[model samples]
Target: MTERSKEQEQGGQVRELLATRADEVSLPDGWADRVLRDGKRAVGRRRLAATTAAVAAVAAVGVLLSGLPGTGEQPPASRPEWATADSVPQALRKMPVGPDTDVPYGTRGEQGKGALRVMLGGRAIPIPKEYTGLRIWRAGDRGFVYLADGPGDVSVVVHVDADGTSTELERTAKGEHTTQLNVSEDGRFAAWTVHPYEGRSQVVKRADLTTGKVGSRSYDDIDSVHGFAGDDVLINWDARVQNIGSLDRDGTPWPSADRDGGVEDYSVASDTVLLSTSDGCMRAYSIAQPDNQRWKVCDMEDVHFSPDGQRFVALREGGYVVSDTSSGEVTGGLWSVPSVHPQDMAWEDDDTVLLELAEAKPARTKDGMIAPIAPQYGPSYLVRCHVEQERCELVDTGGPVKAFPSSSS
Candidate 1:
């Protein structure tokens, strides 16, 4: 059957999946490398600045030169191939722009300062202070629901109406460093990890957004909550094992979603699961029938599925590719410079996506030459790409925006 016909056959299930897919977003890739490189650079700068006063001026200049692009300190970022103004590809022409209406998008405080902001009704609505980590999804016509991390490991689950009214719900503590908040696409359920002191296993807490009632299930080895597939919660079983499994709403273990290997992603909307293995390949499977494989790709990593489950973006060696989910057809691909990589992607609308290009820290090679870029570094840029038009433009969201994609919160 044609992919279109197969999609149509799914009917309401597909629609429901797409609706929830809006809330699904990929986390920043290479986060560890970025943090490590950033830390090293920061220390080097600090030590240089603290040098003897006689050489302070020279050291300051040296620091400045070290950070400048193409100065042997770091490689210059090259423009994405598909975004080049001089060479437009036919495959990207006449691309659909998806929906025109505004959706609630997520943003962090500049430099992770201030409160997390949500752009809604043409204005930025700031969430509560000390923004730890946050996830947002539309609350039907009422406005948006935010699952935010507050000061002191507090989990803030609140709903904001269209008129700017905020109604906060009560939930258990979200334990320290618990930043990821996964919500169902319909905004009906939210899941997070709760680590109590002296506990044997962390508890995965599921909160009902509508009734404000909370349910808890304890697992001996849950590394984190992946997300919700329908009302079932997906979890990363153990850090070492890297197993993916599911749990019922009441927190009972459900092996139906069980799979080995790290999770590339789990589409809560479509109940589709993507897993990556050691051989450097990824495969998509139905969450319901775990054995039912949908598609698989080799030598690809960092997969992010679109909200409609029609397409996905994945990173290859030189750059990234956008592909059909069912058939694994390569729809479009872009060549990227070695200095930068497409670290993250989020669906801005139906046809447009936001890509974050991250710079890597330059290292010294043999013969006293500087090494090329690696996929590590913070403070990345946001580029919005139109899938059909095959065109991408750098997105400037007023001030400095975080490297993460702005989800429909």
Candidate 2:
């Protein structure tokens, strides 16, 4: 009779979701206006800076006083009533302080430089040459290069002795697949989900900068870990066998075995698994469990947490659902994406979800004949129906390619 029991009895719906076209969705009001305002402010700054020389001749300290058109008039970033920065777990706030590189988190590479860069507070410091998909990880007296080579292989290289130069320390074997990559908060260690071809399918590994030694922490019988908390790594392998466990910097195992659960797919924030799934549906899980596990299922359809784990959003019939997980409630949809995370979703902001929809596009490649063409990303929706708002809106990103979450590999 109850939803939980109903889920237990039938194993819930194992149905695959359907995708749709993009043009059907509508953009919310003020969305474009807001972006336009930001653009104008940026343009105004260039004009002001150029005129500084002339302004000095005409007036006294006047250039600094110009304040631009909407400088003071712009509204503060709208923080949703339910989304509080403090409400987020402490681990997220624990990301460390270190030297930065000019690489963007998910970018492959650009302008002869690697796409990856070291970032903090949204500011990115270039990681030297921006190559495509190169993630820059900072370690004490070293800089490590990580590539989000999908759910398959990953590349790791180290740069030593800050002449702003580098060297390739090691390149893992081809058969090994990397799932999770955690950069230590202290910038002294790195943890990765290493699936070596010869031995166990996957294991947690830690690399120490000082000794140049990489070794396994104890193995949790799971597919891979979601992420790390501080220097502690969290492992989750199977829907039924998966458990959340911790590994210290020295590769020491935390006392608790792991939080047992049926997790089909999930995502992690600094210390918590903000999104989790079982055979039935994807729900938000809490990291505060006594044994370190607790997940509450919502009525949301195809639900997931944001890449930053600051918000909860989902897709349902003709609408989407965005909710606050800390509280057992629905924030409803910000707007309909005409889809939600259809194939994969990317967060454009706190208010919108970028849906990568699936559609049958005729392809010329030979692989298309055997496999259903991997769906392409459609558009970025500036939704409001997200989180139970009065109405929902949408924005078109005009995409038709594979995409992933910003902070997620």
Model 2 misplaced regions, further than 4 Å: 1-145, 148-154, 157-170, 182-190, 198-202, 207-215, 218-221, 238-261, 269-275, 283-285, 290-295, 298-310, 314-320, 339-409
TM-score of each: 0.59, 0.46
Q: Which run of 10 residues does model 1 get worst, by summed lDDT?
A: 42-51
> Which stretches of model 1 miss by more than 4 angstroms?
1-116, 132-149, 153-163, 167-177, 197-201, 238-271, 334-340, 358-379, 403-409
Model 2: per-residue lDDT, tens digit, 18-91? 00111112223332233222211221112322133222212211211353321111121332322223422221
* Highest-lDDT candidate: 1
Best by TM-score: 1
Candidate 1, clashing residue pairs?
17-269, 20-185, 34-377, 92-388, 92-389, 95-388, 95-389, 136-409, 137-409
Tens digits of lDDT, candidate 1, 126-181: 77667556666655455676766676656666777677777775444544334445
Q: What lDDT score belongs to each candidate, Candidate 1 first?
A: 0.52, 0.39
